[model samples]
Target chain A: MNYIEHTGKYFAMLKQIFRKPQKWIIFKESLFREMEDIGINSIGITAFISFFVGGVVVIQMALNLENPFIPRYLIGYATRMSLVLEFSPTLMSIILAGKVGSYITSSIGTMRVTEQIDALEVMGVNSLNYLVLPKIIASVVFYPLLVTLGIFLGIYGGMVAGVLTDLISMPDYITGLRTDLDPFHFTYSMIKTVVFAFVIATIPAYHGYYVHGGSLEVGRAGTKAVVWTSVVIIVLNYFLTQMLLS
Target chain B: MIEVKNIYKGFNGVEILKDVSAVFENGKTSLIIGQSGSGKTVFLKCLLGLFETEKGIISFDGRNYAELGIKVRRKLREEIGMVFQGSALYDSLTVEQNVMFPIKMFKNSSQKEMLIRVNEVLERVNLEKSNKKYPSELSGGMKKRVAIARAIVMNPKYLFCDEPNSGLDPQTSTLIDNLIHEITVENNITTIINSHDMNSVMEIGDKIILLKDGYKVWDGTKDEVFYTDNEAVTSFVYSSNLFKKVREVYTGNIKL
Candidate 1:
């Protein structure tokens, strides 16, 4: 489809998802389940990736700032900036775009091919509202929480990595973390996280909800969902950064 | 009664259903028998309002579906139930939960009331003991039974089944067919089944509509199927030697 067609369909799908659910109680129930699926279930991988990347960034900073005139605390400062300003919000989202995106696409695509969605529609249920709305709401609410947790873990990991490696003393790292800490940078990252979260939820859902074939097609849709979600997140990250931080 | 009048449906200008019409009666098992690409599914979907007909009217109980307001259309949908070919049971929900879904969505029943109704339907489908099992754990026949139970949980006025016995053995297929027929009669539902299964056609086909190449070639009862001379119906109904033999026995051409 061309850009206009795809955009129109996407917005149409968005409009459909906003329709009142068949049952509010059922919608609430699904919302909690999705929150668990998209948020709670994702903590382990997010924490692991965030901690390691945080440590790696600190190590890289230590190596690059080998000049005798440069202070050792700059390693901590650089690590803080990277994790809060970019890594926690953007990189973590790209990862989630892969993990959550595939799950949404395959699950909904499977439902489409298996005729479950048709069953819903035949029963007077708005299938899009019943299926996709919960996920979108869950992601929009919980993704920022996950990113916040990621930011904390990543900075702690940086502190641990720098102090253990003896490249920087604990007091010096703490001082660097406290010095010149702009609260706006944290807010800027949170804004990026919210936008990326919306993209991660909706784009994959769009792919999965409209997928028209069997298992092979569902698989292909999943791959396309992940790729598209990541690309959209990156592009949006650029625009959001420009608009919010520039 | 569900009355379809000259419905025309197509995709991208290529017609899949052309000027097809039929009346599916209440309290009877109506089967739409056709070959692959005979527009049986398309016709069924159109009847279910999953696909829109470009031209024609589908009226339920004398009310034109297309002309109904949005609220009325949805109310009409709530009165309808469907059993898909694949069973289409939610993979994540247990059998009991699956059966309870419609009730929970449409009715303001308490959990206890919902469970009671769910167990009642599960028992009706002979699946009372499998409440906690997931769809993945059920056999093909069991899955179809669960689908049936879920479909009838709402006690809907109209029931539509798309290839309900598609992947089951002969005995299981017979069981599913009998169960659907029994339910239709018990609830006085206007049941429409799309099938190419001759066993199903002979066993429970109270009224049969035969379609070929997007047209309704012939329609009649099971007894009439043995007597009809319509080539499209004959060629399809007697395609297999076993069915041909059965037809002969019915016609007394050869004694059993």
Candidate 2:
């Protein structure tokens, strides 16, 4: 489909998901299941990557500031900026775009192919609301929490790297985390994750919900959902950064 | 009764249903039957309101679907129970949960009351013991039974089944067919089944509409199927050599 048509349908799907659920109990159950699937399960990977990547960023910073005149604390400062400003939110969200986004797409897409969605419609259930809303709500609630975790872990990772390398003293690393910390950077990160969370939830759902054909198409939808979600996240990240930070 | 008048449906201007009309009488198992690509599934989807027709007015008990407000439409839809080709059970839910799903959605019954009704339906379909098992664990026949149990759990006024016996063995297919017919008669529901399964057609098709490439070529009962000279109907109904020979014997054109 063309961009205009895709955009129109995406908005149409967005509208479909906001209605009151036919069964509040069912919706509540589904929502909790999604939180477990998208959030709780995601904790391990996000934490692991955030820590290791954060340490690697600090090491890279140390290597780059090879000049003897440069202050040791700059490693901590640069790691702080990277962790809070970009790495935690953007990189982790891209990872989620792969992990959570594909799950939403493949599951919904399989339902479409299997006539499970049709069963919902025939029974007067709003398939989109029943299927997509929980994931959207879950991602919205959880992405920020994950991003917060990512931020704390990233800085801690940086601190670990700094102290172990003996390039910066432990006190200096702690001082670096405290020094000139603008609360707005976190505000900026939260806002970006919220937008990307919306992106991650809805875009994959759109791909999956409209998918035609069989199992092959469902797999295709998963790949397409990831690609589109990541693209939207990157693009939205730039805009949110420009609009919020600038 | 469900009446669809001059239904016209198409996808992207290419017609799949061409001004077809039919009545599905209450307390009877009416069927839409045709070869593949003859739009049987599309016709069923149109009847189920899963697909919107470009031109048609389908009514249930004199109430027009198009004219019903959202709340009313939903009310009508809630009265509909569908057995999809794949049975369409939520893989995540156990048999009992699947059966309980619709009653939980439409009624305000307590869990005990709902479980009683769920057990009743599961017992009717002979699936009471499979309550805790998930859809993944059931055989094709068991899954279809579970699908049937789920469909009728709400005691819907209308029931739609798309290819209820498509993948079952002959014995299981007959069992599914008999169960559907029995439920339809017992509940007095306006049941419409879409099938290319000839065994189902011969056994339980109370009213049958034959579609040929989007057009309703014939509408009649199974007995009429034996006598009709309409080549489309005869060719389709007696496509098998055994059935053709039986038809010849019935018409006295061949010796016993």
Candidate 3:
């Protein structure tokens, strides 16, 4: 479909949603499923990625700052800055794009290929409202929660690295982290995560909902949805950071 | 009644439906019979508004389909119940949930009322005890029954079935056809069915429309079909061995 037609259908779906919002029950069910799938199941990967990323950052910082003149406690400040501004949102989005994006694509694409969407249409139900809206709502709502979890794990990983490497004393690490951190930085990271979550959820669900052909086509669509949404997440991350930081 | 007039539809310059038109009456089983690529399915989709016809007007009960607003279209759609070619039951939902879906969507029935309606429809389809089974666990015939039960759960005025017996055994196919016919008569629904099955054609074809290359080549009653001199239809109909045996029996050529 062309962009104009697609956009028109999207707005039509939105309009249909307002007419009968009683279907919010579907959204609630979807949110529950998405939270479990995207958030709870993702904890392991998030923790692993955060741990390794923190370790890598500390190693890189130690190698570069071998000059005895520079205080090693600033490593905590550097770690804090990267975690709050860049790593948390970016890494969380990448994980979500792989996990939640693929899930939405597969679920909706399966529904589409199997004619469940058509069945809904035949029943005087707006398929987009029933299928896509719940997913969009879930992503817009739960993505921030997932991002918060990501940030918490990432920070904890950094703390683990600080203690293991002894780059700074434990007290100095804690003090440096507290002194350099700004609440606004956390807020900015959260805002970015929210936007990324929306993109991850909406793009994949859109691709899946509009998928045609059989299971093979749905599988192809799911792959495409993940790849394209991840690319969009990365590109949007750059632009959002530039704007927000500026 | 549904009127499809001069409908033409094409995909990628390949015509799927070419100047097709037919009238499906209320309280009758109107079967569209043709080969796979002969556009019977496409024509059905056109009637259902699933695919847009490039040049045609489809009117349901004297209202132009294209001119109806979304709300009106939805209201019109509520009058339609479709049994898809594949049954199209939701795998994740139980049979009871699937049957309840339409009622929950379009009606103001309470929980108790909806359950009563679901059970009633399930019983009507002879599936009262199988409400808890998922689509995956049911047989092909059973799934088709569930599809029928779901389709009619809303008490729709128009019912459409696409290839109602495509994958069923002969016995099951006949049963399904009879069930659909009986339901149409009982509910006074204008039922349009797409099928190439000669068995279905002879069984429930109160109004039969034969399509060849997307054109309505023949439209008449079932008895008229057997006697009609349309060479194309005769060749198509008599290609079945069962019809040939019936022809033999009629001609008194059977040897004891």
Scanning candidate 1 chain A in windows of ten residues, the lowest lDDT window is A170-179
Return the number of clashes found in candidate 3: 0
TM-score of each: 0.98, 0.98, 0.93
Q: Tens-digit lDDT track for model 1 on B97-145? A: 9999988998999999999999999999999899999999999999999
Over the stretch B29-65, how does candidate 3's per-residue lDDT look in tens digits? 9999887799887888888888878999999989999
In order of DockQ, best first, we have 1, 2, 3
Q: Candidate 1 residues A1-246, lDDT tens each?
A: 887898899999999999988788999999999999999999999999999898888888988899989988778788888899999999999999999999999999999999999999998898999999999999989988999899889988888888898878898787778879999999998889988988999999999999998999999999999998999888988888889888
Worst 10-residue stretch by lDDT in candidate 3 chain B?
B247-256
Error of 3 at A147 (Å): 1.3
Model 1, stretches more than 4 Å misplaced? Answer: none
Q: What is candidate 1's CA lDDT for residue B70?
A: 72
| DockQ by candidate, in order | 0.87, 0.82, 0.61
lDDT of model 2 at position B193: 93
Candidates' lDDT values, in order? Answer: 0.93, 0.91, 0.82
List pairs with backbone clashes in candidate 2.
none
Total backbone clashes of candidate 1, pairs 3 or more residues apart or in separate chains:
0
User: In DockQ, how does model 3 score against the reference complex?
Assistant: 0.61
